[model samples]
Target: MDSYICQFPGCFKQYKNRCNLKRHEEAFHTENKKFQCVHCKKILSSKQNLKEHEFIHTNQTPYVCREPGCGLRFRHGSQHSAHKRIHVAIKNIVNRSSVVSFKLSNIEEDIEEEINPKDMMDFTLPLIKRSQDYILPVI
Candidate 1:
């Protein structure tokens, strides 16, 4: 029934309670950060914020695209969702036969570069055949 408003210039955001207004101010209006990252020493305001920041140091990519040839990795769900739009656009363009081939050629190259050869089940090393005489004994 009551509203607590932020008094900062140019920002008149209103909150339902005093506690929320204070948190909003501390998070945005001030540099009074409480949580410090152990890996990079970066300061954050809350535990959730610190946890999100820690992903950068850990190189964690929990959100993965399940598209057939893509398999791109992302740290956040929003990033994964945004990447899916590119695939959708590609599918829409595929109806146009001429542009489809040219665009897909470039996209396939980019996808190939992003994919790790070791992760592919079919990836293998080339074998060289040698005769018995060519195999010399080690000294």
Candidate 2:
């Protein structure tokens, strides 16, 4: 029985040739893994590796299409088609907002400015937060 080094850190498999590795990947690694190895021409066994492969093949991003009235942002035509169905043509009218009285006994009445919704979007997109932000910088 020969042992082959798994490019994935924690997988256990033994193979001596290309066909054996391919069989191992298909049988035990495909759907369970996050990414396929590019060198093996196999789908990754780790999500990390899949994402890394994407970066290497970034120029091959062929999936794209614009959704009507959606302002055009999606990775694939199917995604854009899905968006088009959801962002329907509906006329939205912003009627002057009427203030309702809610009595709060302990709060002061010093709040005078209205919160603009558009301003929120300006500040919000930057603060959407990403998983990468918390990753400690690799020195």
Q: Count the backbone clashes (under 3 Å) in each candidate.
A: 0, 5
Model 1 worst lDDT window (10 residues):
130-139
Per-residue lDDT for 44 in model 2? 63
Per-residue lDDT tens digits of candidate 2, residues 83-105? Answer: 66554522111111111122221
- The candidate that achieves the highest TM-score relative to the unseen native structure: 1
Model 2's alpha-carbon lDDT is 0.49
Deviation in angstroms for 52 in model 2? 13
**Which segments of candidate 2 are over 4 A away from where they belong?**
1-62, 65-71, 76-78, 89-139
Write model 1 residue lDDT over 1-139, tens digit each, in one string.
9999999999999988897788778878998899999998988886756776788999998789999988999886658878999999766655454455566677888898788777888777678676422222222
TM of each candidate vs. truth: 0.41, 0.22
